[model samples]
Target: MLETIRGLLEGKPGDAPAVLAPERETLDYASLRDLCDRTVERLNALGIGRGDRVAIVLPNGPEMATAFVAMASAATTAPLNPAYREEEFAFYISDLGARALVVAEGMETPALAVARRHGARVLRLRVPAGAPAGWFELEPEEGGGAPRAARPGPAEAEDVALVLHTSGTTSRPKIVPLLHRNIVASTRHIGEALALSPADRVLNVMPLFHIHGLVAAVASSLAAGGSIFATPGFDAIRFFRWLDESRASWYTAVPTMHQAVLARAARNPEIVERRRLRLIRSSSASLPPQVMRELEATFGCPVIESYGMTEAAHQMTSNPLPPRPRKPGSVGVPAGPLVRIADPSGRFLPAGEEGEVAISGPNVTPGYESHPKANAEAFFEAEGRRWFRTGDQGRFDADGYLTITGRIKEIINRGGEKVSPLEVDNVLMEHPAVRQVVTFALPHPKLGEEVAAAVVLADGAEVNEHELRRFAAERLADFKVPRKFVFVTEIPKGATGKLQRLGLAQRLGLVE
Candidate 1:
């Protein structure tokens, strides 16, 4: 496997466009390589190179995409969500021990103050007005921290290329450092799973700070010598227009974004008719089977749902493209790593049994950084191969199709009767008025926890709680049915647009 970020871009046609954005000129492969070389040289001059952490805070766009590839080639790149508050920024900057903070020129963000307080240098990126998309130069902020001796070159296979914090839904976020080998392996895996080629173009709407966007949307496309149509961020209203403009062959997004696109898609009939998409991908969350069906019907493309997480770099399993059967609810077969079901005692389970999902492969990270306790709990040796427990409860069919029941932690325990939230979600989605639904555990005084659901109704749709409860009763057992139904126009989402289930009960004031 290729072991370096720089290696992912090598051997491609130099003149082919690699990065593009709405109304911006294209950045070709040759120019992109040049940018990486220059960026590495500049970082080396600034006394920051391999082994040093550089925290990046920038809005979603082509520049963020390019900066990631370039900085990873040069040093360890930690891309933070730009929407973080001052306190959040302070925690991440201090936790990462970032040597420098990279932000767009003239862009004011809380990260600036956090970096300054930590005594980390600030590097401003300048994007030339008429330059191609993703083309930029990094300059040291005035009065930046003093320069120290630097290793000064592209990172090696063993060097950490990217560091991302786990979502930390149940515990404090752990730092995950993916080596160059892990990233390259995952990149190639994604490219192969999607059957990508130089002519393939992806209209990426995922945030750059996330593993799904950084690897699946950017690295995979680039590795296949394909182009990325980078957007500022996901805007459902403008998605059709951009799709028409970019003439993109495909796009990848979370289920929430896909739902939003579907909501607005009905209004863009002409664009939908003229656009010819080869495929659509959904990941970073379990795309509800309802959304998957609607997406395939609306766009006239296969909706490929893949399973991923930060520990695995990104992709773990993906449904194969045409010629192979694509199971709607299942996340498809293992596309990148060797996946298996493991019992609580760390024993690998055979097919047709539900247990925790585990994986072992080149793309899997070595372990969580600086946390021996987490490492001990996460990684274990099994069947002569070390596997990382994915914390997801799932099972595989005899045919090798994997079905994710739900997050092990997110499964509802109503008087010890286990209820898979995903199962409840699929049942509720059958209701005509329901556009989206997230089933979670609500605190129950007697049972300890009860099943509850937060639902978003379709446009102009109306359904009383009693009616929905009745609707659920017919499809689910009494224990599996949601006792409380909270209807809202929109469900709260995380920074990267994933529908968060943990802590949702408290956020919705249903924790009593």
Candidate 2:
């Protein structure tokens, strides 16, 4: 399992750079391997071993990446966001049964208090000001202490490598433990789909805590012996500069990040001229067809929309890179496993039929950690194989391209008519004044639930409720048009950085 990561640090192109950070220094294959080895020794000296859980509360950057590799070498790694509040940290730490918490020196967040309260060992690493948040120089123990022993040989495929909490927008977060085999299989599949090789370089701006960043961007690059430019965060200015500096061949991010990049495209045409990007990947949230076209036009590259979830490790279906038609709105055909649409009764639906999506693959997780009820409701036997029910509504086109319509739970029930908020959102987003939009259901005494929308206008743009309602009315049915329109500067996003629809109404005071 570690062989993939190890190989990337050993047998890559001699001139290829293994990792490029936003600032500070870059590391070649040899340096990266040495760092991982030393980091593993440091962690082992702290008493972390196989089966132990090390809670890593850090941000994106080289340190977080190094810590992840080091911990996975010796124990289960749980990387959480540093922005989480005290209550959130408490819940996650307890839920994962973390034995130790790694924090940056002088971090004043509630995570530090919670970690101490839980009696979890706290190790402080010193992070330089311009360095990545989660990354810090691990100073050798005082007085030249004895060197720690090396970690054991490669871990078994079935050993749990990572334990992460789901973005619990509607309910309590659940722990999702992914085994080494799951990571290997998913990363290998993603690398193959992208046709990544040692010569390819990726510019990764996504947060490392998310599965998309960990598996799709970082793990896949390592598995394929490719290089990655790890950005501290998504900065449009720095991103374009790095694109040319690192000679990045491809990049991956969420739709929102893509929109930000497109917004800045007109300012940086020189980067495109110098270093042409091969492909742009989008996931985590649905990418609108309009934005996809705009991005492809601006970057002169195809936008590959992929369908994925944390439970499936990461990529399930990705639009083929080239030689294959890139569907505008569809996520494309199943890439590595059996994907089928299932009705509410668990019966498999025929192609081109809208229903809940189900998947059975080697990359899929066995079940949620210690959550028997979730396991019972989420998985079922189909044709002697266990299939995971994804609470998403989608259908396959004649060409086997999967187009996700909406989440089953997010569908708005206006009287007896069901309305897909995503369908309405896409149309509303087409308006020139509409910068960001989210459609949700608000509780109503008469209609049981009414369609409502929250919108963010572009800079210096204005659109009244009446104008917005009229715009949506032209493209949607009466029931589908939002009954209430609320304007806001921005929409709230979860830890994974995806917009949440389940509890938006309550949070915005639109519903009781």
On TM-score, the candidate that comes out on top is 1
Candidate 1 C-alpha error for residue 506, in Å? 1.1
lDDT of candidate 2 over 216-321, digit per residue (tens): 8887887788877877767876778878777888999998888778878788888877788889999988888888989888888888999898899888898998
Q: What are the TM-scores, per candidate, against the unseen true structure?
A: 0.98, 0.92
Model 2 misplacement above 4 A: 1-15, 126-153
Score each candidate by Cα lDDT. Answer: 0.92, 0.80
- Error in Å for residue 281 of model 1: 0.4
Worst 10-residue lDDT window, candidate 2? 140-149
Q: After superposition, how far is residue 424 of candidate 2 from its true place, in Å?
A: 1.0
Evaluate model 1: give its lDDT.
0.92
Candidate number of the best lDDT? 1
Q: RMSD of each candidate?
A: 1.3, 3.0
Evaluate model 2: give its TM-score. 0.92
lDDT at residue 346 of model 1 (Cα atoms): 93
